[model samples]
Target: MGRNTRKRRTPLATKIVAGAAALAVGGGGLVWANFYASAHEDHGGHNRTRSAGAQVATIDCPDVGQKIRDVPDRARGEVDGELASMDSQITDAYQRLATTRRAQAGDARFVENSILGPLKERRKALIDRIQLEINRAGGKADDNLDELAGCQGRPADQQQDGDGQDGGGGQDDGQNGGGQDDGQNGDGQNQDDNGNGVAGPVADDFIDINDVQPNSRNSRNGLAADGDGGSTGTFSTDCGVNENNLFNSDNLIAAPGVDNGAHHTHDYVGNQDNDAFSSDEDLANADTSCQNQGDKSTYYWPVLRLQDGTQEFDANDQGGGAEGNIGKILKPAQAELKFVGSQQGDVVAMPKFLRIITGDAKSFTNGDANANTSWSCSGFEDRQVTDKYPLCPEGSQVLRTTNFQSCWDGQNIDSANHRDHMAFVQEDGSCPEGFQAVPQLQVRLAYDIPTPTVENGQVRNPYAVDSFPEQLHKPITDHNDFINVMDENLMNEVVDCINRGEDCQ
Candidate 1:
């Protein structure tokens, strides 16, 4: 292979998600176990190197769970314990994969065959045993092992069936696990007097199209919101599935906690398994609790919390926080969601199976100087705002604005960089020459953290995202993803709302 030859992960290890229904634990939370890749490198099979910004291909695992229902009663514990073990082994193997990839001479096939393949077998065996327990428990072992097996190590491209569409099979267990799976039980179990629980929502559940938050707040600095001023058409919707405890095993890139893939968890809304490895077909069929029923779009990010000391709201809530790693999840004391158009032309319905990412994931280091970020206090954008994460005052909330480009090049649904196919809205909020203007999605996340405490004569940093021991955590590290599943009627309604300048629920 040439020096620029990016190692393509041939179908070897498929993704196996412990779907929300079957993997849901006692407390109502859900989890899954898998080790797979998410996306591909933009470069032609090249060794990923930062010197030239080479993107390396990775092992994108399939999201599995719906096939196997969780065994009922205490027997569930046995399967869960085994699942936990599989998660650990997978995480360890992938951590090694990540480490080896960093070396110039890293061999992708060797990593898959030697490091990851063995773990896969171990995991399969454990899952087989879990299935037996489910059958013995009278829960009906209706899981499709064939389907689950098919998910292992398949490419995103081949995910489609012969019909050339995303082939989503199996059933949506319908047992919503967002509230229960994140190490807590019941709705509002983690919420306190301040309202920071997994299912607790704040502010207006629906945003008025005419009343949008200021896209740009930085004055002294020339920084603009990622998609600010570029909005030609705009509408708002509620951020879906705001639960924090899902152990979604379909992470494309193996971050710090890749071994127990889902342990280093996130707060998910919208389509439940919105992790890196999810596809359009999977998202489309996902049972969501968001408004506009058929809209199956998925959106997710790291959960933010107060690191000081609350049993459930402790430091472990952030990314890699479970591993005693360096990063912490920063919450926006407040959040907002909106859609903008990237062109002067009428906003059109986003095609099905569209994939897009906001912010940048590669840059989320532990706690380094992060550039290309926008932060502000809920009410005081003038003073409490800066590129640095501003700690919220008592009763005040912090806000981070992430705007994704909406113009599609009309060719590829996704790119190696998770960006290439999509272009940002122009300063005039219009799409460029060959691009079509779609609704640019905006996610405004809020956090609840007080001023950094002065400990040992120094102020500590509070607002941050997940980071690993090796990966330097940076602010630009905060990133999110989206796959539109809005039903045609709902999407058209949004398009009409933007075109007619009418406010809506």
Candidate 2:
């Protein structure tokens, strides 16, 4: 009954059915048209674009997987090279350490402590650097593998020991290299010329002569002798002249004389009584004791040659001709000890006759040869004089045998027992009141003191004599004594001698 009533169909319902049918046909036609078009076209261009896009996307994937695969090989090669270098450096450091130990053993107080600390540090650093490089490489490799395996999201196994823990074992190798750079030798010890481990400023065996500083008092411009008040003269000798004839002999005042008539001498007789001599008559009679005295009284009579090449006969300048004496009273020439030791004496004695000639310092001419006679008995009061002109007496004589000694054996003085007798003289102190101590430079320039021919050939400084081993056997000079007193430690005393002063044995 309901169907019969609805049979009279509604316009809306009919229209809905027609629309649905039309839509189905249109949809089917669109699908058919699409299928047909796809089937007909070759689609080669489209296929290329799609294929290229897919290839690019695949290529963009992370390279971590490949890098992980290579890490083990790279790490092994690098570690091998590093370990080889480390081995050499370690060997060097070990050797240096042994040397340092030996030196310290021989000398108890040797201090070379600065080396050990730096060496240890360097060794540690080298090991650390290697380990760090290894660990970094390993970590990169691990990270790449983990990412590729999709294991990156998982927490790392921190508990694993072999992964990187042992890799840093040689971290101190760098420290060893650094220590070597700081002068620690292969054995990690310092080297010195003395063969001692006590590292100090290096000593030089040879010093440049040009670099040597000149002694202040011995410089060229220092301590010049004054000769303006004296007269320049020459003298001649007469045969068989007695003391009276000797004193009264014309032009004899400045004539060179001899000690016991064997060795030539020079005397410094003053022109005025108060000046140096009492008077011309006194000068003429100065040899009264020897006038007519036997040959035993005669001293060596040497001729005096003046700068002008003139000669004198009597004290009054009475002799005439080229051989005649001049009126000037010849002053004593400054004497200097050119050589000090037996070896030096041998060297000097071979060339010269060892005669003491008197001449004016200013004129460079032979002075009164008789001056040696005056020096014979004179004693030197000043220690400086005794040290230098030990041949002189106090007052009466100009020279005495007691004042002179062979320089080779002259340095000995029992200071431990003879403290009062042996004393150092000051630089300003007098040698003798009349005589002066010549500076070393003056001795070299005037007397031509031999200099060291080779590097470190000899110790030429008078002060250096104190340091000489040979001098230990000789009498100590006043200068040496003074130096000993000032610096007692400089005395290398080896024997049980009284240290009245610093004694070097």
- For TM-score, the strongest prediction is 1
Lowest summed lDDT window (length 10), candidate 2: 29-38
Local accuracy by lDDT, each model: 0.42, 0.20
Candidate 1 ranges beyond 4 A from true positions: 1-233, 240-264, 275-279, 309-319, 325-334, 364-372, 382-387, 455-457, 460-463
Which digits, one per residue and each the tens of the lDDT, describe model 2 over residues 136-236?
A: 67533232222321110000011112312111211111111121212223222321111211111111111222232233112111222223321111111
Using lDDT as the measure, the top candidate is 1
Per-candidate clash tally: 52, 83
lDDT tens readout by residue for model 1, 352-443: 76777655433311111222245566676544222244545576666666666777888766543345567765565556788887776777
The weakest ten consecutive residues by lDDT in model 1 span 165-174
